[model samples]
Target: MNRPRLAVGATLACAGLLAVGCSSPSQQAAPAEQAATVNVALSDAGCSPTPATVPSGPVTFAVTNSGSAAVTEAELQAAGKILGEKENITQGLNGTFALRLEPGTYSVYCPGGQKDTWTFTVTGTGPAAPTAAPDTNVADATTKYHDYVVSEVNLLQPATKTFTDAVRAGDMAKAEAAFGAAREHYESIEPVAESFGDLDPDIDARADDVDDPAKWTGFHRIEKALWQDRSLAGMAPIADKLDADIATLKANVATATYQPAQLANGASDLLTEVSTSKVTGEEDRYSHTDLWDFAANIAGARTAFELLMPALQAKDADLAQQTEARFVDVTQQLARFKQGDGYVDYSTVGDADRRTLANSVNALAEPLSQVAGKVV
Candidate 1:
């Protein structure tokens, strides 16, 4: 479900610029701390790296895209788990993402490129020495953020029920409307759900995210049935599966725990989601409700950042202020497309407007990426 950059090129319909409840990995390294940095290039052809092995602990992938229109993002993955990623890299832009990696080979994936994937190796040296014990601010941030994740799942079940009910009843209008609404809840807390492993994919994976067509079951599968196929027949079973999956998600998150950096990374990941998949309109391709998702992802990012505000501000007041300003910049741009509760249809969005939104997201993402480093 993580390698979505390649198949996503469509622009989003609306730009809600809403708040955050958002994904995870654990590591603690301040920006001033030294770590192994790997430079990865994403181009029209594919992903490339300097190819140096480093002892594993803390590693940052410095990503740069040159002369590539299709390649919008890059991800670092091993064992089907997304370790880290940097997204929304329009041509001529550079981005970076960090993680505490164990020694192993990882894939550098950039879709819609000539090559699309590359191998990078990390030597096992274990994680860096632990940082000082976290202060109360960190504890509060994690505790509140975990509750936020649980809240989203709570909303997701009932909202999903509304959509599933509509589908079962064959009411296309209500189903479509409910579909986007339910997704907003899901997208906002995607990072938390993602932490639960297969549940994320089972509940939200797109057609492209899976290898077997039979394995494709989630909001997207139901989406295709309603929009592309234009019928609700045989949807009841799929709806049932969705109910089960989301129920399972709720149960899993009830006991979930989080680290400080994981919250920061989850916030950043949601923005990456918007920049890469939601912006492309590829996520809700059949319905063209990309804006709804765009807004929800932002909502999640904001929620996480705000939850960590105390710790972040205490550590680096300037960084906190800068991140807040960036969020405002993105939200201001998105405000132009507002249409009552939602925004205009994605198809109606002009090319210039698309560029404006993309630029704003890129700007917001820039400062947001540094958050984990600051707080941790």
Candidate 2:
């Protein structure tokens, strides 16, 4: 069942504009003030220089990945949202990013399975700058993302009907084929699906989420019956439940609220899902249709990024261009694995190709994380 866990902690850290220390050549010279710099080292154990305290002003983070073979990402977060991040910090590389901070508590997330938490405090007496006025750009992006969710959910309705009908007819071969088609539409709108109370778990819950085996219902449960058990005797009810839940999602998404930051966070979360479970074939263990889900997740995330592009470009053109380029690269890489209108089975995808796909996803996730900061 491709139940996606939002990778909210992992954030983007990258090169951005340096703070101006002096006036331009055509203007009078001003006093030079060096921005504060923090050195952060990430390893398998934990981040070094833990619990750092800094002044409230422009600060630069010099991050080094001293971890093992597993790639790591570093991020600065506040109020459950990423403020800044640097991603794809390979075993031995270093990266840097600059951000202006206000007085507050923040955490540095080093996502590579490291459990140790690193937090910091920003303190200063300097008068805070006036907050920027709310812009319509973010509102527009949110509306677009909401519309996308509704469209995907609507697509799911007809697809689910076909899938359920195949199951009811006891045509196992046709049902199995219809399963992937129906799942693609669901996966594309998973974030929105999850917003509906209990609907997501009802339609896509894995066995782990259920306390009792008999209580488990929805796609994976039906999948087990169709593939592992090789029986359709008890699957019609599960199909009906899935159909109802999807209908519920269709109605909920019509009034769902979206934030500009969610688009960026959701994009990163999708890639994290691909790297964590989808690439490993753990998501669709029974049917081996992980590729379909993986592609749909990527499509969903890419759509969010595309909708936020205008606002992101206005704030940071360089970052926006970098993100778009990486998205194209990843999309092209995935296209290589396509077979006709669908993709090859996850079981048949080679290890090298999987690694390539993972790398491309990580590359895209890096810049995508910055979109929130730029747009919001």
Q: Candidate 2's residue-wise lDDT over 79-143, tens digit each?
A: 44444555556788776655555455667766544554577677765424334444556557767
- What is candidate 1's lDDT per residue for 196-300, written digit by digit as tens? 436777888888878888868889999999989999898888899999999988887787666566678888889878877877787888888888888898889
The models' CA-based lDDT, in order, is: 0.74, 0.68
How far out, in Å, is residue 239 in model 1?
A: 1.1
Q: Going through the candidates in order, what is the number of backbone clashes in each?
A: 12, 4
For residue 144, what is the lDDT in candidate 2? 80
- TM-scores of the candidates in the order shown: 0.75, 0.67
Model 2, position 298: C-alpha lDDT score: 90
